[model samples]
Target: MTNDSSRASGNQVSWQKRLQDNFDKYIRLVLTLANNSSQASGNEITWQKRLQYKFDNFMSKGGMSVFLALVSVFITAFAVMTTARYVVERFFPNGPTKGTDDLLWEIFVQLIGLRDTGDEANFAAKFVGVITIFMGLVLFSSLVAFITQQFESRLELLRKGKSLVVEENHTLILGFGDRVVDIIKELVLANESESDAVVVILADKDKEEMDDFLRNNIAELKTTRVVTRNGPIANLSNLDKVGVKVAKSIIILNDSKSSDNEQFKTLSDARVVKGILAVVAANGEENLPPIIVELHSEQYRRLAQNIAPGAVTTLNEADILARILVQTSRSVGLARVYLNLVGFEGNEFYFYRSKSGWNNITFGQLPFHLLQAVPLGIRHGDGTLTLKTNKDYKLSKDDEAIVLAGDDSTIEFFPEPVVQHNRIGCVERNQTLELETENYLIIGWNSKTAIALEEYAKSVVKDSQVNLAVEVLTDEIKAEFENIAKAYPHIKMEVMQVNMDSLDQLKTLKPYKFNSISILAGSGENAEEIDAKTLTILLELRQFFKEYSAATKTKVTTNLIAEIIDSQNTDLVIKAGVKDFLLTNQFVSKILAQVSQEPDVMSIYEDLFSLDGSELYIKPIWLYFPANQIGKLTFADCILAAQNRDEVCIGVRISSQAQIKNKNFGIYLAPTLDKDFILTVYDALITLADDQN
Candidate 1:
């Protein structure tokens, strides 16, 4: 029994030993499997992360980069399929052996979905064929989408006006404003004789918006082709894009919307200065074109000229408008004469340099030597203009005749003098009405008010009265008026706060008593609103005058001059019985355009508008022709008569045709010297003289 028990124990122990050995082996196999699984998982995760990072980076570079990446993937797929087919055919032979060219061609066709792998004996060849077909679908779809996106991107760039202009001798307008339409219209008229002319505009405005605005404003562009681009005017790249280097002329317009605000005007002037600098920098100093800039402040105007000396021509709008207002207020038909003189639609000033016949000719006789033009001044070789010179002054060799003609081509110097002796009537002496102290009325106010008042002080006789009326009376305005009054002690100045809306209040001032009434545009409003207010006041004044004249049966001869901000509203005002009105923006724009074409004319305008120089006046017809010969004399006779008085007969104003709009309000400028006119005693002669007398 003991022997049996010991044997059973040994057997159990051996069995237990065998069980432990099997369990150890199982544990070792389990750890080995876990280790292998972990390493394989780590490798797969690393590979996935690398692919993700590369894809993200490629996508972040934008659509073009993504498109290029897709193209690369397509090429890689094609290469892989081709190589795989080659390998399968060489290492593992297919059903039929194909040449290298045939193999590559077949792979390409399959990848593009043009063909399928038919009856391929090799399994590897079939697998690669299917993969290539799938990749082709994905890659081609992505490529189409990317190509469409690229096309859209290109269209967007075009809409933004990012393309450069390829033009030469074109007019480059650096900014846009209310004056742009007028400038362009004038340019169109100026370029009517040319076959093709371009006016490229670069402004901080939408290209489409500018195009639409211009299309609506200008009825016909004639021969001028307008191109618009959107960008900062002061940017060098933008200036280059507009072809600044090859430009014939450059006009920098002041921000008309900001003209009333000092801060905004300063910023606008700074931008103009920067734009001028940009133009000069873009096109070297030697290659700089004639640059015309309109600046509100005189300081900036001087600065602009100092920067580029002879290359820059600056315009002071306030000064010019003020002078024109004062001069226009002094006469009844002077505004029409100015309108006829400064624009391209009518008689324009041109510099005529004769080859030989004009040498040593007297200024008075030069008019007879010209066919259709009137000699107004002489532009010397030194660039000095002598306007309304003495008839006895002789022409110099370097002098260029500054004549007013309907067209430049019509300005011809005839070798023989043309004079109609029969139509030349004797100069008649007429009594002139003189008033030592004049009464003037100024309604509303603007930046031009003080300057106009100063001009009045210099122009009017001693003890002349000026009554300034306004809707709102602020200390600033009062102070400005006081300063002006202090400076001009010769004139009696009166300031009153009157609501222009109240006709009764306006009547209380006895506006009919004033010799001349000037209406100025108000501030703090857009041009349309300001013009509306001005038009309203004008209608009110006209109504009051009509009623007063009818009620008292007394003829009211008050000369009314209104300031019109928009040229579109000029016709409305004119129809409202405003014989004389200043189209502010159009007037300035005409001057700018004319000066850009001929910078020397600016001096002529400056002199013509100033008080110290010779000015335009409408004198009684009897002063130029005898009362008996009023209806029988020709325009040439009138010219000869004016020459006797040391004056220039530029035009005539007929009372019978005064209300006729188509007849130029009865004002004829640079009329044919032999054209006969049936004039009455009431009609007047338009002449340029040293004084009204």
Candidate 2:
């Protein structure tokens, strides 16, 4: 019995051992399968990621991607054709076979849907031919669709102005605003002498819209070709695309929409600074072209100059207009002279450098040598400009004549004097008048109002009265006026809130009592609306003056100086009997365009506009010549007469043509030496002088 029990225990042990070994084998198999499956899944994921990465890289190349896609389609088509042709030829021996080239050509023709399925002897070959035709249809359709899509994309890119400009020596303009059209118009006139001049404009605007605006505004482009590109001007890539490196000059215009808002103006000025920096980056500091930038803030202008030193030219619109306002207000017919001087359509400022003939000639005698040009100043070799120099000042070999001429080609240097001795009249210089206190009536208000007031303070005598009338006066405006009044204690300031639209309120101001009436452009979102308000006020004042003259039999001789924001309204203003009107946008744009052409003119204009140095004035004809010699004197005689008084006579204003808009208010600049002018005591002589007297 014991032997039997031991044998049973050993059998149980053996069965348990078999179960353990089997369990161990099953566990090993499961782990091995899971490891293999995990590795395989990871490899598949890695392969897909690599394929996606390659496809993204390939698609990033615009034109090249399309070309490669077409090549791949062709390659796949060839492979499929080879495989199908071999299967049909090898599998169905009964079918009629063609040469390799013929078979390939047949497949190509079928792929393009040019031919139907050809004859085949067996069912298998016929079946395969049907499949090939079906595959061809699908592949070719997809290929055509893809090509069409790519073509559309390329066209879209072109419409968006993403294409690079392949030009050199072009005038590159980097922003768009109200001043752009004026700048372009001036550039067009300036390029009339050049056969193939180009002006490229880049801005953050719609390309089509910009093109349309330019086309409608510029009636005649003359010899200039304007090309526009749409992009952020502050982008380096965009700067490169516009060929900044090869440009001759660049003009950066401020945002017109932001001109009224201080916050936006700050932002706009920052963008301009960024754009200037980007230009330097694209072209490198040493390779930068002449850059002309318009900045509202003085801080930005200083910053820009510091960035590029002598390479950058900055313009302050408000400051220029303010100085012009002060000068024009004091003179009756000086606005036309300034317009003619700064613009390209009329007499323009030019620098003439002569190698031999211009040396050792007095500043006053230099005008006698030139046939049509009038010398205003001398530019030294070290780049210092002296406008209205003394008559005894002699020109050196290194000096350049700053002359006003109709065109650069008309500026000629005669070795001998071309003086018309008969036309030269002898006259005595008139006595200087003392500066007197005056009353000024200013209607309406704008950003230039405060600056204009400051300019008046600089010129007006102590106890001069200034009356400001506006439709609405806010706290901010009141504060500004108070601050200006405090800053200039000598000038008397009076602010009144009057409804300018009401003629009764305007009549109460007694505008005729003032010496000068300035109608400023009102503030509004629409420039037309602002100008319309100014026009309304102007008409009311004129009617009131006419009626008052008839009722009281008192001669009212108050000069009207209107500030026009849009140049298109200049004619309307002139027609309304406004002899002295300022086209604010056009004037600033002219300066910017002129400076871009000749950077030295900026300093000349600065000197002319500032009160510290010489400025333009339209004095009475009696001031330059005696009453008896006025009618008999030629323009050259007047020029000589002005020289005796330390002033430069550039033109004459006739009182007869004062109301004629087409006659340029009777102002003739740089007239021929032989041209005779029958001047009167009432008529004025346009001259560059130290003071209004």
Candidate 3:
């Protein structure tokens, strides 16, 4: 039992020694790791306190190592000294043999001298080892720092460039169309004060095509910044890459897909809307803004609205065609006049209440002699605004007045002594001269024809005449025309199978050199072939008109307007010298975007174009002024002129040479300081009161 107890004690001592050794090794390993990691982390390094911690660890482990090495060296020296002393005693216990004593003392003195030189060498070697170890640590640490900083620098660059990655307040406009240039032009006008306003366009087209278009056509966009990214709109990931969540608004363009017209529009717009909604949902509404959508059918409008409430949505084909029908039926230059009022280019619509002396005055009394500004119309609370109300219709205090030139700031004062106009001056006029009868010819037929015919009927007077020539006339459409033909016997309609491509056959109509012609899109399988055929027909028609006019010795005004379904193909027709080309595709998409935001805007527009007391007109502001004396008037002064004449000034068109300040890029509105007040033959459109009649 005693032997067993002793063995157990010995084992316990050995285990204790092993545990101490392990603890020491672990401390050393931890110190090494801490020092290496701290230096290698670079910018990610901890504070100075962590460095102090590492230094403390280094001192602990290093001191222990130095102490152990010193102990081993001391032990070796002590053992050697004892052995030398023992050998001396063994040879001569009492004293060194008398003869050997001298020899032993000499040897001992020589060894002592050698030991001093060895100690010097040992000190030098230890000093060199310490410096080498420190340098290796520094060199390794510095290499890690350089590699880490390089990686961090690249990350910093990426973070900085993320702003350019398309984010909030940036607008995304898709598709390429004839109206895109105009739409962008208006956006630049709208966002003039912003420093970093961005308009990014995503199109499945060559970047060069868009670049060339802007370079050649848009000179008005002087300083506007627009970026273009090329890709298909069908891909959700591609849309995400453009940074949809950061966008202020997304305008999904109609007619940018390859499929059936209605199906393609609905599908493509749906896809865009879905992608935007997904991103917005993931980003959260509090973070992501809204998107404006476009649709081809009235049926799809409801779906779009459901998907994104308050988003702009419209049936482009129907609304545009309806407007064309309404406006064209009015008169020539009427559409241009209407454009000034409703469009962003000219003067925008505004409301103000008449103050003081201007209060309670009839439309007739607010002319230039009394009020300093022109009174165009009034907008009511129910979203009804008239361009020109009746003359005797006295304006109340609550009435929202629409002015031609001035807004709320400049239209504050009313001149003293209300100016009155002579009633006799309003009536006594010479008999209206008889207008010469003119003939108009229309070619081609489609759904657009219905609107075109309605417009044509309204533009011409009852005394004027027109002839419609069509190929492939339908029985049902012909039946509808019978009722229209009954209303006007002079509107002769004839159908024939003659080919428009054949010049000889087209010459048979002899539509007079100066007659107007409109070419509408028709059913065709091959777009390129149809374009080629259409081009041939138009050239032949022009040639025939030129030769026939010269031979007949009759000069007539010929205006050609082409309706292109695809905006991308509009350039070909525009270059063909067509005076006016309307890309319905683009027009409809824009209308959707606008009405989606403010549906009542369309109502205001409709009222502007109506034939009631408020109607759009292009009466020269110069017509009402005295001979050659109207100075370069302020926007306030221009409004005064309208107020005096019972008219509304919507916009002003100046010559290319006119110099203006604070003008937006591609801006066609706002009069210049140096332009002559003399009314040019080419006039601008404003709203007029029927009371002037």
Query: Could you say which candidate leads in lDDT?
Result: 1
lDDT of each: 0.85, 0.84, 0.53
Which tens-of-lDDT digit does each residue in 323-420 have in candidate 1?
Answer: 89888888887888888898698999999988765757799888877768888888888988888888899888888988999998988887777765
lDDT of 1: 0.85
Worst 10 residues of 2 by lDDT: 421-430
Model 3 over residues 104-165: C-alpha lDDT tens digits?
44333333332221242334333433443343344444445555765676565443322234
Candidate 1 residue pairs in clash (backbone atoms < 3 Å): 636-673
Error of 2 at 269 (Å): 2.4
Q: Backbone collision count in every prediction? A: 1, 0, 21
How big is the positional error of residue 236 in model 3, measured in Å on the Cα after superposition? 8.5
Q: Lowest summed lDDT over 10 consecutive residues: which window, candidate 1?
A: 423-432
Top TM-score prediction, candidate number: 2
lDDT of 3: 0.53
What digit string (tens of lDDT, one per residue) describes model 2 on residues 1-693? 899999999999999999999999999999999999998987776867999898888978776696677668766876877687677778666456678887777677776677667564467656656666777788777778888887898788778888889889989999987789999999999888889999999999998889898988889888899888999998999988999999989999888542377877888888999989999888888988899998888999999999999999999887888788878888877887888889688989999976565757788778888889999998898988888877888888888899999998888888777876443354555577678898887787766788888888878889999878887899988999899999999899899999987899989899998989998876777668778878888899999999999999998889888888889998899778786888888898899998888887899889988989888888877766666666766777888778777889888889899887688779899998878877778888888888877
| Model 3: residue 387 alpha-carbon error in angstroms | 3.5
Off by over 4 Å in 1: 1-133, 256-259, 356-359, 419-424, 428-436
TM-score of each: 0.84, 0.91, 0.56
